[model samples]
Target: MANIPAFKLNDGNEIPSFGFGVFQIPADGTTYKAVSDALKLGYRHIDTAAAYFNEQEVGKAINDSGIPRDQIWVTSKMWLQDYAYEDAKKAIDTSLNKLGLDYMDLYLLHQPYGKVDEAWRALEEAQKAGKIRSIGVSNMSPKLWKKWAPSFNVTPAVNQVEFNPYFQQQELRDVLADSHVALEAWAPLGEGNQDLFNEPVLKSLAEKYGKDVGQIILRYEHQLGVIVFPKSVHEARIKSNAEIFDFELTSDEMDALRKLDKGKGMHDPDAPGVADTLLNAFDIHAND
Candidate 1:
């Protein structure tokens, strides 16, 4: 397994340059085992969300790994119903209790819903109180961040989004540049998008470099300064994903991958039905 690098956050904290994501990990023992495998394979950063409902299992896996708490960086997000200030505050404690951690390395607002300002307020307060090391947003685009971020006392340290060769997020990066916020790529492998890894450009580069197409794309993102936490349950894949750091993607190769961008992927936070579906399915509330 290759060692992963850590990047500096706007808050003066360090974040792993690469990580393992537990988006759809089952709540059963599967999560514990996979997380344990990732840790043993040298993945120090693990990203999970409250909506995933596997916090307890992730916690157990970390505890069982015998890795010191300071060595592993854990991140979880606040979901829809937990957006209000009071709920967001409580949700921090809830996630902490579930994860069996003294404090999270990072926490995020899971979606763009009403009461987001209040949610941000809660995160800001928590950082001050030493509950979370850094705070950020997930699924928030530049357009959305511009509208509401003016009210934030502490600027968002990161914006985790669906990023891959397919959706390079050039426009999003332009805005985040002004705020100095990091862009963390979720589903960094396009979640196995055939068009992504199967592109002739990626194939040619992978062959040229004697690496997999996934490694080529991850290297691309790494050079572009986007944070990526690709999820995998297989031990082989988990081990292979960390190998990108050893090689460098040439500028020409990076440009070729950039041209492969289609700017489309699953889950658009700005889409019309997103809010309604979340509100109905999750019993979202704007109040504490």
Candidate 2:
């Protein structure tokens, strides 16, 4: 098993350096098998969300794998439909029930919109009640963070966002640093975009390090102290993603990767009418 390093959060909780992400993965035997394989291959952390509709399968995989719940880290998120304080409270319990877990290692607001302050308060209360170990938000920009952070009685422990070589949100990263919030990267591989995979600099680094381009990018993010979780349903790819801890990226190589930033992410959290679109489009219970 790989001894993945853990990064301590501002709240003094330790999160694994790498994890397995379950986004856009179907909630079926496939999810169960993929998660079971990841655990067997040494992934101790698993990320899922209400929107993904796979919490039940993820929980079952963890349980059936016979891994002690304490040895595995589980994270889930609250969707927009349940952003009201009371609704958020119910949503947290719903997620916990769906995952078949008593407490979540981390629970995040799935988006920056809706009743964030109310929803966050609910998260804080849950933490105090021992329902969640840590509480945070995702897809939140620095501007949105600043506007609401002061009102938070319990500061966010992690801020997950789309961070990759192609779209490094340096400004938000800096803000997160100042706030002592850990940056958890969601799409660390640029969603397998051909443009990112075909970059000459990344290819050169991959050849030099005896790794694939994906490994080079993951290693770079690991070197920058960012938390990364790459999603892949394939068994070979899941095993390959965990091979990053064996190597290190040099300062020059890291710099080269930084220069590939396009100064913008593929998704804009601040885009006009984004809240309205997301709120109405996603139904976490739709699959049921």
Candidate 3:
């Protein structure tokens, strides 16, 4: 377990730049074992969500691993089904109880859907009560930020979005920076998009640095100041994902990777039917 570097949150707490993402991990006992393996390999940050349906398993791994709670940064999210102010508050408590933690390092609204501002209000109150250290949103875009900005008293500490070489979110990044909101990238390895691994620029840099294309992309994003947490089911890939800290990518190499951006990635966060989809997805199990 080596010392991993951290980035300061607007709230004054520091978050490990690299974390273990459990987006698609099954909740059927696999998450517990896999996350325990990651913690054993020195990963102190674990990202999960109620939507992932693995918070209980993730919490089990963290607690069972014998790591001090303060040393581990745990982040979770509230599902759209729990977006009402009162429901959000209850959901927060439910997540805390499930994780078996007194406080969360970061808690996000899983999507920018349904009573978002109201949901945020619940998060703020929780933070004030010491139940949550930091609060933010996921799948947020600059357009959505504008509509939701006026109501915020405590600006979000982070905006986790779909960011990668193939879909570099430079414009939204700048807006978030102005508000001191750190940009966190999800699906950073292109969300299993093989084209990302096949990019010629990434391939070249990988060969030059004696690393894989994923490592090159992760290093490049870190250099760009974007917090990245890539996910994998294999122990080898989990260990390999954390190895980006050992190398440095030249500015020119970074620029070369930057050129690979085609502004393509996941769904638009501000799509017209988000609320409708949110309402319809009440029975959907995200990581079942």
Candidate 4:
């Protein structure tokens, strides 16, 4: 297997450029097997969320994999219910206990709203106390970050958002770039949108490279310096997603993919009050 590169965080910590995401991994023994399989396939980084309700499964997989703790990178996020300072602290401890780890490689506030300032403060305190190595936010709009950033003692090291060829998030990318915060892409494959799979440009490039269209898309994103975590349950697809290191996308191919941007987001941020109502009404957390 080709080695994946690591990106240096603003705090000087390193994260694997390619990681495995367990966003919708079932909260059961299946999660354990899937994660263990990924680690055995040479993936050092694993991203999960409390909302996934499989932290314990992920932890069990890591522990049973027999990999040394320091060699593995584990990331987890806090949900909105735990946004208060004390509550967030308790959440972190619960995550640690569930993960069976002394410290987390990365911990992010899962959304942009709901006592976010308090959550950020708690993350900062966790870092100071050696419970977490790096801290960031997810699904945050630039406008939200602009209002929230000034209140922080620590700048966010990353912002996880929905990104793909169809929704490149150019404006948010620019804002994050200026702040020196890395952008991490969730749903990097557009949640398996068939249109993306059938794109002529991607098809041509995939044919040229003798790889799948998904590989071409991933290569493009890596070249653009956006971190990606494309999830998979099938062992073949899991292996294929990590095969991005073998090829490179040319400048023209990059440009072709860039033109596909529709300038819209598929997911909405769950801010407090009305935002939560909207998100709940739409069943934002429901698996598609």
Top lDDT hit: 2
| CA deviation > 4 Å runs, candidate 2 | 286-288
RMSD of 3: 1.9
For candidate 1, the clash count comes to 0
Q: Least accurate stretch of 10 residues (summed lDDT) in model 1?
A: 279-288
Off by over 4 Å in 4: 270-274, 278-288
Candidate 3: which stretches are off by over 4 Å? 284-288
Residue 241 accuracy (lDDT) in model 4: 89
User: Which of 3 and 4 is ahead in lDDT?
Assistant: 3
TM-score of each: 0.96, 0.98, 0.96, 0.94
* Residues 29-140 of candidate 4: C-alpha lDDT, one tens digit per residue: 8888889889989999999987888898999999999899998999999887778899888989989988988999999988777788888899999999999999999888
Candidate 4 residue 31 C-alpha distance from true site, Å: 0.4
Query: Between which residue pairs do clashes occur in model 3?
Result: none
Q: Cα deviation of 213 in candidate 4 (Å)?
A: 0.6
Q: Order of all candidates by lDDT, from best down to worst?
A: 2, 3, 1, 4
C-alpha RMSD by candidate, in order: 2.3, 1.0, 1.9, 3.1
In order, the Cα lDDT scores of the candidates are: 0.88, 0.92, 0.88, 0.87
